[model samples]
Target: MDAFLFQVLAGLATGGIYASLALALVMIYQATHLVNFAQGEMAMFTTYIAWSLINAGMPYWPAFLLTVGFAFVLGVLIERIIIRPVEDAPVLAVVVVFIALLVILNSTAGWIYTYTIKSFPSPFPKEPLFGIRYMSAHEIGAICVTLVVLSLLYAFFRFTPLGLAMRAAAQNAQSSRLVGIRVGWMLALGWGLAAAVGAVAGMMVAPIVYLDPNMMGGILLYAFAAALLGGIDSPMGAVIGGFAVGVLENVLGAFVIGNELKLTVALVLIIGVLLVRPSGIFGKVHVTRV
Candidate 1:
């Protein structure tokens, strides 16, 4: 029982990581109806920036804030300089651009930092949380942080004017523009916000997986699955899906398949869910009355 309980707790901790990244994916999807294939690469680049600051003697929290800020600016620039031009282009063109961006970021990171992995410090203590041994302090703290972020995001979108504007722009650009909202800038702001959130995911997961140029590659896949599972259009669903997938991974990895086959498990879970419910569990099917 103890072992099973520990696995569940561990799953929640890892789930927090997935929830963060999945939230970023959902944010972009909500605004643009498109996925940023390079989201993980962008996160990797920003994490490297944080690493540099930390190495240069900056404290963890300050470096983390700076990295998130840098990521926001970078995201806005990319949207304006690259995405805005192709906003009305074919889907293939946008995908190709994302691919190109991914390649460029990956190559630049390799050239600048090499393929080596670095250790990241966790702000939480090394000991157990609240003196319990079921989970480590860092893991609990990270989960708490993820939940807090999700709550804040919910409040922002529900109670804040800017959030409502962003939602309006995403739902109907022409309508939003007719009502005096800057649709394009709202999209750009969404990109910046997604980037900032991705940076947080990167920073939080770095302490566990260690920091590497490709650290977020597999994580991105899992996040995609989580987003799809939770209803990509719904932020609340995405977070719940993340925790579900994380728990599934841990439990399955330990009980049924070896840890080596966990990725395959996630893939199967995605396929199975999609086959059963094309709209995802929480996703609603839209009907257009012509």
Candidate 2:
């Protein structure tokens, strides 16, 4: 039972990482109806920025904040310069652009950083909690950060006028334009926000895993599976799905299978979910007007 509890806690910590990235994907999908395949790469680039800052004598907190700000501006700029031009193009175009962006960012990082594995400083203490007997501070901090970010995003989308405009534009671009909303800018903002969120996830996970150009690649797969499991259109679903996937993966890896096949299990679950419920646990069935 203790081992089970420990695995559950461990899963939640890992799931928090997945959930953060999944939330970013959800944000982009909600606004633009297209997944940003470059999300992980963008996050990797921003995390390198944070690493550079820390190496330059900046404290972890300050470096984190600076990286986030840089990530936001970078995201906005990328949207304006690259994505906006192809906004009205076919979905294939957008997908191709994302793939191109991924390659560009990955190559740049490799050239700049030389692909050496580096250790990152943890924002949370490494000590284990007293009395809990098994829970680590790292795990606790991850859970807290995840919940806090999720709450803030929920409030932003629920209460802010800009958020409303973005949602409106996402639902119907033509209708939003008729009402004078800048649909294009809203889409850009969505990408910017998603990028920033992905940056946070990357930074948080970097300390746990070694920092590398491909650090987020595997996590990206887990996140995609979680997002699909939870419902691509539902932010809350993404969070829930991430946790569920995380826990299942951890437990199964510990008991039913080896750690080597954990990702395989996650993929299998994703496929099973798609087959059983195409709309996902929290996804709404879209009714297209013929």
Q: Which ten-residue region of model 2 has the weakest summed lDDT?
A: 126-135
Question: Model 2: per-residue lDDT, tens digit, 124-198?
Answer: 876776656566787788788888888888888889998889899988999999999998888888888888888
Candidate 2 TM-score to native: 0.95
Clashes of 2: 0
lDDT of each: 0.88, 0.88
Question: What is the lDDT for 120 in model 2?
Answer: 87
TM-scores of all models? 0.96, 0.95
Residues 45-89 of candidate 1: C-alpha lDDT, one tens digit per residue: 998999999999999889988999999999899999989888889
Task: For candidate 1, give the lDDT of residue 15.
Answer: 88
Model 1 residue runs over 4 Å out of place are 288-290
